[model samples]
Target: METVNVAELVERLGSDEDAVRKMAVFKLQGNIGDPSFADIFIAEGGLVRLRYLTLHASGNTLAYSLTSFSRLLDVDKGWECVDQELVERIVELIVTHPLVNILRGAMSILVSIVSHPYTGNRTSQINNFGFRALKPAIAIYPQFLEMLVSRLSSADHALCANALQLINSLMRDSITHDPEAEWPKFIQKLQDLGVIRAVYVLMQDSALQDLAHPLLEFQSLTKVLLRKWRDIPVNQEKPEHRRALKGIYLASNPEKNPDEATENGDDTRRSRRHHPEKWRRLGFETESPAGEFYEVGFLGMMDLADYVRSHGDEFQNMLLEHSTKPSRQRCPIARASLAVTSILYEHFEVEKSDMDDTKTYLISESRAGFDKLFQPLLLHWTRLHVAGLQAFFRLWKATAAEEEDLDKLIELVRILIESVVGGAARIKDVQDVEEELADFEYHRLRGLQMELLELTYEDAWGQHLRQVREELHHEALQFVKEQRIRSLLQGSWFALDSHSRSEPGPVQKSTATYQYAQLSHNRRYLHFGQFDLMGDRPPELDTLPEKISNVSVNPDHSSTATLKTAPRQPTTKITIHGYAPSTATGHGKGHSHARSGSRTTQKEVVLLTLRPSSHSIASEWLDGLLMLLNQQPITAETSKLIDLVSNYGLKIRLLNVRFDDATFAGEAPQVPARDGLDEDYYYDVFGGA
Candidate 1:
């Protein structure tokens, strides 16, 4: 433990045998801050010994060795201590050495020491040391890059675990300004070395937790990927001849980014229209007259593109001459490949070229070929299958609490329904909700809902679950990403097609209008939506032009086009006016369906059917109805009504809540109807003069 003993240990290098020399050298691995120790290691190649094992230790010995080096990393100078320059130089040697095991160990130590969240005080010396070290480690030896690409492909849990941690540390400090300086360079190195493809392939595995933080968990890298892919490249000055230069740089690094938005990066966000030819889809098909090409089997299809890169043109001629693309749509191979390529391009800007020796490829051809190839591949594995189902269950279990089951379960059914709707090959187990829907999708949908309810019945939050019975009354008003748009098919949502090779209308699934919405509406909401239902009527009600309205060409068109059939009046607020005994609701983090806090109306509604003698009593109330329908915002009257509802609808004076433009907050009268109440009571409850 003493410096003299450590020095003695250090001095034993260059011995007759490799084993003792290795031992004596590693004993002082982290401990040897002595300039003389560096001298000894340098002569016998300390790095080579450090490679296999830091010491003959796993926990304490390893910890002490790493800690010793960490101790040196902070020193200002001299033979006995570590300083910034020395730390940087030492790290450079350890990680860049041929034996990757050494780099992994030293980095494990370095990252642990710097990122100890428990450290009470911020250490500038440590920060400087880290900055100095990380930038060069990335530059001098991106061999870890190859290791990353290799380990990610391996099924071993240990490899996956260590790889995730190592890659995660590389980008943690990208958020702040100071770290940004060195961070970008390291990112570029990763990008240049094709690190992104490896990470993306790992993400598709899904066995790993989705919630892992970027600094500590690789999932955090998703934000960076998404961010990079979502925007147009800033570089326009480059020549088209340099199309092969279609690459990404660290305009920003992942470390300084705190939000982790940059982690799950989008390819469109970072890609430049570089490599016009490279960007193109498969321009020409390989000889239509050729023989059957190589056929790969199902399950565990190694990423051919990645494999090809590591192995070279080996997979390029991986042909399918006599073979035909699988007729089946749900192949996982296609899908996983799609996921793999998208991630590669977005995260690493890694080009996956098809060297079929066929013909020239434009950006469009390259894109189309890739998409067609990837789709069937996606369905190759039943990723959304039963074990996948278990993974999903775990995800929900981790994210939602016992009481949050209602929402979590609902979301699960929704995703499953999507797989079926997308034609995913779901096994026809007795649990399937669609089996009962053979007669009609709507009834089948109800069956689906019932199944979801049954599954969650034992959940603690089960009692609170309410079937979301009513579908949206309006169809065309679907919200995607908070912007309203004309939805495509009923119940089908939209996402920007990262695969769309088009230029101006580059957005996928957009159909001229998709990004507008991210609503809570059920998929079926669009079927009977206002856009489809309103044949014709008042031009004022017509969101579309008159020319389009005339296209219906029916005899009743004139009458329907008249004002009588104006679109349903937009009601700004719904104030269910009723009296009730008191009720209570649990406190929540503002969840939409959280229980109310008071005892009052369990079920409440204002009856429009029966007439009140209101017309004869007061003319002023008519103005209030108009106000309610129009939904003017923040009117004193509306605020008062909101306050009353906020307090269990106790203090409201009017049965009406004026509209403040539809969808405004505090619109719904939050009161509930009390059970066991009288029907006739509605008449007398508010009949007092």
Candidate 2:
């Protein structure tokens, strides 16, 4: 590559000849990736010239200028040169651009600027700048989001992908940087802009099937954003109000001891510390440890649930049409559509006493519309299958008042449980247990089983369906036990049967124990001993603290001396770090408790390492241990359900997929042929240089 002079390119960018200016901008675009070139270009005023062209130039010159800015924004401090005025200009260009190439270039610049890794104090400030700049365009242009949604159906694949990516980036940046205040407003804006309706139409368009991956991401992120918005503090009160309440309570109750009040306050603070983690496990985002938020409430009547209900006929028809199609097993758009619909229905709630007859009729009509979907949803082996089952239970709980309705719902539940049980039995017989444990369908069946068990345990359902509930519970437990045995035989981690024991006991036989390490049934202790082939002696067990700090997997084993002589299998070294009760007595040296006349138990940080047979088994053990540490439910069925929902329902799988370079790179601008045209024709067709 020839070393081009940055000063010359900057001069040519302001040339009177249109072709000369266009070639210079294209050359600048190709070279902006170089740090040296970028620094020199900025110093030589090349960036200022490019920004000027974006406003003054048109067609190929304008598109290439934006593309160059997109690349330059990746360099250090490149965003600083683009001020609020320039950002507003870019947003304006995006709204008014006629050609697909121009739109692609403008959107790519926005994505680069929004998704840049701004660190330290500048992160929020820069994010706020970008959002503030777009506010005017979004406010003035009512069709901004709809215009982007329309691009989802464009023939240009690159343009379609870039449009979806830009939307995803914008939403992600809003929630991630400022979830509490700005995200809720952003979501409301998107709703008001009719983006949700546009999404519904795009999802139904069969011509856009190739854009399924990004579509799923957009759908899933929308659902997540709504849930996050709901999780925000509804009561936006100041901290002073809480302090005032505390003072009032203390002043009213003079008999209350100050020490007792302090202790109670401490307990409340401790519980608040764990509140965020608990809600996060249930798929809700939490901003602070205080976790002040309401449950998913009615976000007025225009929420997603209301939208689906209002369009019940069309929504049901879409479901029926997709479910009947004979296509590939994996339908990203269809699966995502059902998942979103399921979430909407699940979040649907109404106050019966406050509801008028119109509201009641709408609810009943929506329920009936969903009732038709249960047959096809149950037949499919997708993640939506479990979601559909859960939606059915929730809807039934909300509206099923008559005994005939209850009877029909109970029979449907019975059939679903039977189907899940039969599926599990066949899987156990035909498939490898290890593979089945990792399969999504296997987890889906497990989620169905758990949902059925939960239904059986409900007080209202238990009273009406006593005999059937009993049978379902018994079958579910039997299936669980069989799975536990199979998982152990395959050398994978299996949750111990807690019903067999009242308290912590010896390690369960169903748990796979390596030669020198074992985890107790209650998962409260880890036992380690010398390697022994015979059942001769017991291993020394140490109590694990309630909170485990960390669990890590290390693949390198050559550093350990014990494994030096052992044959190297596909091994993985697992390390755990946490606090454990110290074994030292009060009489021992360095015992501060002895001097203080109090024999308080001291805790010490301990590290434990174990070598598992294979990487997959190590990962299974790691997941189980992390779950135990996080205080999440550890039953086999619950684990499977959490995995299924996190992966498919929440579309967490999108975290791994990203837009590559090709998605952002715009097609080269086409130049007109100059066979018989005069030089004036060039200046007339294109804008003046």
Candidate 3:
């Protein structure tokens, strides 16, 4: 309202940063509703500038533009003074501007122009420039396009990409109801005029493939365009097709991780979300934002069917098998990768007949041969996942990384848990940390604390977790295996019996084993009375048996394996240290005091002390234990002995061994000689040792 105040505000606008100036402009902008002061700057010789920006541009015009555009696009109250003409002029200047620093900001301003609801009263060429206008710019100015393309060839990869994207925007198309519209006729004319091939060559220039997510992205643009338009054929792979396949490969495999925080079974198609303006700028021709998605629907299936028909069913089936059961033989992530690509390959099958003819569609069996096809990619993903998981755990543990690195941690979670284990119906926390770490409690405890940290402990401790997660890596593999078999059964793709398909080696069936009351010859994987642990063990030797139980020794059962006869070595009698039973089953077994062998006759026991908790359960062996402890105990200890310490809620029993059944205890074709370990002293030393 006051001239002095306006001049003061204008002067202050040039100080420091544009953000402060933007606020002044924003505040002053409201005062213009009466239209007393003009919107333009009056310069010398009657020259007019649309707006005076000298006060705001302190060698940071881009930053200033960002501030200006932000207020112009504010959802609540957009600046009516900012018209589409000003936005378009700004965009044009940004692209051709000498300073590249302002490009992103200029792009933002253009985005604000269309996206900003306040351009209600504006008129500009951009109102009609939508997607359709951007698709055929080469015909309008081929030499200009060529010059820009050449200049971009020397630029950095990202800059080249941006140039391509901007070029696409310049030539993009907009929606129109009439098929016979002037623009459509113009495009057809461009095609008729031989501009299509030449322009296609220009766009396919190898230098800027990443600019748009084109089918051309898969390989160098030059190769792709040359393959399509050149006279000499290279018989090369189609870049666009591969890029589409790769895109499908990456997106469809959203992990069903038990370790994730999101709800499972929600829509798995979130990756498809796109912006219409971006679609317009990228020159997408179809109704969908990504024309590739539509093209894949129509052509992807047909191509795959032809592939399977050429490769044959046997080969296809082999691909699926390699993925599912790759134990020492199979790779886990390799299987997942094949499954990812396979499912995605089927997703866009537009015609049922097209799908049926291709054995690669839908059936899990198609994934078997993917070890070869997928190994390199799988290895890359595996390395990435491992690095990510390790970093995530580190961050989680408050170790090398920090809680502030959650964006990376969450990204890792998305990849590992959400994408890999998507079908986990439920999840629970892993609470048996103590049990799982029985062998190395202290070291494992430290690791556990570090990993569990302040992150996700409640979720980890909850129930149904294991069910959702257990053998996930294994079970998903099985699902993939069965899926392949299902595919073979469909004559639509690879008919199992089809002669036209590959002639495969006969499917190898595992020999079924039979063990019966009378027959023994049928056992294939085992030999007479032999057993081994699935994993490695410390060398087990027949050393003296260690007394593990709290129960006192039974002196009368004098077999060599169970005997505790030794010249009394008066060692300090320390109570054996041990862990609580890790499982309900181990707890239910109570004090584990029986002699080493399943049979009654055993000799030589290593002395052990029990924890206070398990002492009562071993009362039967107290007298023998006390006898073994002493070189001599009063030998009046009797045959059927019992004692009750009524005040302490205690009972005791003592038994002496009988040499009479020693022969029977050592029977052939009988039970195992030991329960805990090869040495009799194994139990006593387990935790305490």
Models 1 onward score TM values of: 0.30, 0.39, 0.26
Q: Please tell me which predicted candidate would have the highest lDDT against the true structure.
A: 2
Return the lDDT, model 3, position 341: 28
* Cα RMSD, each candidate: 28.4, 31.6, 28.3
Candidate 1 worst ten-residue window by lDDT: 546-555
Model with the higher TM-score, candidate 2 or 3? 2
Runs of candidate 2 with Cα error greater than 4 angstroms are 116-128, 140-142, 177-182, 192-194, 197-220, 229-689
lDDT tens digits by residue: candidate 3, 1-689? 44535555555455466676656555544443332233321111101111445212434543454444443343322344354444444544443555554544454444344332233433444443343332243344344334434434434555444444443333233112223434334334433544333333434344322432321221122222222221222121556445543443233222321111134335333422332222211112332323333323322322332333443342234334432432233222222222222332232121222322223422343333221111111112222233323323333434333324434434333333322222211121112211221222333444333344312422433343233233332343344333322321221100111221122221112121210110012211101111222124322222212212233233232222222223122121122222222233332111233323332442233222211112211222333233333322212221212111210111010011112233344645645676565554533211110
- lDDT (C-alpha, whole model) for all candidates: 0.33, 0.48, 0.31
Clash totals for all models, in order?
Answer: 114, 0, 67
Q: Compose the digit string of candidate 1's lDDT tens values, residues 96-172.
A: 44344444445555554334322323344454433344555546655545555455555654445555565655455
Better-scoring candidate (TM-score), 1 or 2: 2
* Residue-level lDDT tens digits of model 2 in 200-282: 45454444434554555565565465455444443325553344323322332222322123346657546443433332221
Tell how far residue 525 is off in model 2, in angstroms: 67
Give the TM-score comparing model 1 with the true structure, all chains together.
0.30
lDDT of 2: 0.48
Q: How accurate is candidate 3 locally (lDDT)?
A: 0.31
